[model samples]
Target: MDDSTLVASSKSGIEDRLSITAEFYTLNNVHANSAKYVLLFSSDPSSVIFFGLSPPPLINNNTLTLTSLALTTSFRFLGVWFSLSASSQFVLKQARSMVKDMAALLTLKKLLAQHVAYLYNAVLLSRLEFRLQTSLFFDSIVQSIIFPMFSIIKRKAGLASTTPLALLYLKIPFSIQHAFCRFLLGKKFLLILIFGNLPIMLFLIFKNLWVLRVVLLPST
Candidate 1:
């Protein structure tokens, strides 16, 4: 696919692409390098995307090499920052005064995602030769995709002093936004919404409470 097609596809949902990319990284050494190169390309927006071609600094060593895995994880980290930068722009469109705090939180998330991605990639690289099934496959996908997405959402919400609970608002797209807002005006709005989305709402509430605690206890 072309560059625009690839970027548009990324919006489709990174879950499937992450799984497929993980599989490729498992099978071919080239894919590992390609993943790193993709991170590099993401870093430099002006860099030309050489579709269907080998990326810079070819992977000449064994796929299981620690050096290879380290580079891959490092770039995966840079990828997280790249995602945060883009998401920050979106948040700014909504809330400009929060930019400084948003940048700080985004930096924190970038570091956290890096650590998590490094650990996950290390595990995958070590188990490259082992037989992987659907369960483990999905587990890996969740590790790679969901965790990073959560980190981004958490950081974005932090910008507004909103906490991760704000991610609940994000789960619903703009199309349903007005409806949710109208519903929230009802007397039992939180009660109804909580009951309707108990599991997620609870999780979000926990995150929100955590933010409140942090705000209330500054020295803690």
Candidate 2:
């Protein structure tokens, strides 16, 4: 078959699979409400390609179409922001706003060091660390914004701006926190592979061997 025909057939197959899944859920009485929100996101870095086309409409077994699907530049899923270009800029922006608001409150209240730490853990830190596993692109930009806010709070609380003091009060730096989260996720994946079926176990072993070979052997 021609490329265009193959593409069309693949699209049809995907739509059919979605329809069958929706029907299964409907039979199970899932999402009995008529209102449904669907979003289409393209991972393409180019804006032109990302926004060029709309996703296919999803229809239920009763022929009810989900018309609520809209083209959005970004959307929140499971507390993590996902953008069309796969950039973490939106997440960083949101984190900045949240930290600023919390900082303003801390300054206005003239909160004690202990109180400020509690507030930071409850509000600002929670937001910063929320779904950290999903937003690994939060790099130096996020650290620059967050660490300064910590300094401001520390100064207000009459604490030194030293790294040790910051670490003592904040428990761990954001970079370290990110690394810990990644390590935990890696461990979880390893455990899954260890207990997984034969095919998955084989794939994991092969993947690790390939990675080790790539790291140990120089490219010729």
Candidate 3:
């Protein structure tokens, strides 16, 4: 089918699935009030064409009316900024704001190097590390913001820029740090697959293999 047809089919399938789930919950005496807060996000603008001329409202029990979530450039959810285009611009903006806040600490020159390092780790690094593994964030752009701050901290610690901050701070490089986080995330997901219910494990394995066959193998 054409791209437009596929998009329409996908949208219809989502609505059908939501209706089915709501019915299932109601029948089982389970209170599934997902319509109250569920947000329908379109990752691509072209997907809007799938909704037809007038998309139907998600009406539950002829009372709760759920409208299509308004298209937004970005929205914050659980402390992470998600953009419709999936760009790392939001993350970069947040990182810049954090750098500004952290830089203010540098004015306290009298603070010991270890103290400053502790503050940086506690205040700045903690924020940057949030949801690091799952998101396909622009690593280079983020590192550009981070490394300079690291250099500043290194200078405060009486270490030259050439001296690797990782050695002095007992931390890994930004790239390696992200790599480690990804590794941990993969392990966590793998554990879930292995120990989860048989149906779930089978479904996930099938999905992974399908992706590998359709995308990875063809690319290679």
Q: Estimate each model's TM-score.
A: 0.16, 0.46, 0.46
Better candidate by TM-score, 1 or 2? 2
Colliding pairs, model 3: none
Give a tens-digit lDDT track for model 3, residues 130-187: 6343344444655666665666667776777888545754553222233234435545
In order, the Cα lDDT scores of the candidates are: 0.30, 0.45, 0.47
User: On a 0 to 100 scale, what is the lDDT of residue 49 in model 2?
Assistant: 12
Q: Residue by residue across 1-220, what tens digits does model 2's lDDT show? A: 1001001123234344445545544465444332322323132222221111123344334333332212345555444565544466667677678777767766767556666656655656556666343455434565665665667656765657774533543453222233333335545654565577765756444331100000111222
Best by lDDT: 3
Residue pairs whose backbone atoms clash in candidate 1:
none
Q: How accurate is candidate 3 locally (lDDT)?
A: 0.47
* Runs off by more than 4 Å, candidate 3: 1-40, 43-72, 131-134, 137-142, 169-220
Indicate the TM-score of model 3: 0.46
